[model samples]
Target: MTVSLYVPLASPVHRAPAGLKLGLLAALAVALFVVDRPEVVGAALVVVVAVGLLVARLPARSLWAQVRPVWPWLVLLLLFHGVFTDWRTGAVTTLRLLALVVAAAVVTSSTRVTELVAVVEWLARPLAVFGVRPARVGLVIAMTLRFIPLIAERAHRIREAQAARGAARMRWGILVPLLIQVLRLATTLGEALDARGADAPVTPPRRRAGASTS
Candidate 1:
């Protein structure tokens, strides 16, 4: 089961270039990380959310729903940061990551995964000069984007199945089976790729030895 965060709303944000959205998201992420002041990050979070909601035309309910699933992790982050660092620092870090997550959600919801992969391939084109394959990078990006929702859905179903079987309390047991399930899925994917031409080994370019004077 794939979890779709996309809201089909005709808005400028939705029509914006995937490359531009990705770049802006990257810049904002760096800015949030670089500026550690809680006030600044908190304010930035507000702007990010507003852009995601108002500018991106994402329904407020949908935006909040995407964020809702992250509360447990967010709490853990704050607790860890607070225990080791100051509360202000913790708040700054928490808000910074939350802002990035919201920003990414906005981008992903608006843009198609194929568009993003094309942008990545374009961005990584220069690497081809150094014997690197940009298509591989694009393929990895596409696979990652495709797999995130699937993996999450699988984990959810696994938890539900365990609960139904009276093993709800055995979280550790669920982990083992879930991991094995994921590994099996990976193996199947690998086999499919092998059936295609993607299994070919990509050898690195060898460095030439410098001229030696006898």
Candidate 2:
């Protein structure tokens, strides 16, 4: 049942409206780019950490697991900035990236995929005049979000199997098989969608502009 990173914790963050959380994330991202000061970035990170620990009430281990996959990328970014640019800039950028990723993890951890899809659909409704079907867009976003964790799990399993076979250094070896598996999964999903009458679409219920705070 726990297909994604969502933790069923009863907290204010979990009860807060997803739309507002998303908006806050967006605002923080903009601030990160526009504000160049390390002090500001540090302050933002303090807030992020506070929310993650005190507000979300997530266990330290669970929070670490949620952000573990991105550590390499974060390190790479830090190293690149530190080498080519200045150490202060590198540190600030690293903090910015970490804050952004953690904010997203917090949102996804609290919100359900279906609720996120609905929120996205509500936002995308105006694009209907541009010939985009809101329902289809929502479905696409929902499936993409859902499959992300699934693919990550698959990749982990493949890596473990390769390690067990003494092919620990064969990182690239996982690529071809992973791609093929992803394609097969996509095909299966498409078939299942068709069977569910996705093509014979009816009007989707209009999503409320305001998200549920409960």
Q: Please tell me which predicted candidate would have the highest TM-score against the true structure.
A: 2
Q: Per-residue lDDT for 153-179 in model 2, tens only?
A: 899999999999999999699998899
Q: What TM-score, over all chains together, does every model reach?
A: 0.60, 0.65
* lDDT on C-alpha atoms for all candidate structures: 0.83, 0.83
lDDT of 1 by residue, 60-132 (tens): 7877777888889889989998998778877987898899889888888888767876997998899899977
Kindly give the stretch of ten consecutive residues in candidate 2 with the minimal lDDT sum: 205-214
Worst 10 residues of 1 by lDDT: 205-214
**Which portions of model 1 show Cα errors greater than 4 Å?**
1-4, 132-214
Cα shift from native, residue 213, model 2 (Å): 49
Error of 1 at 209 (Å): 32
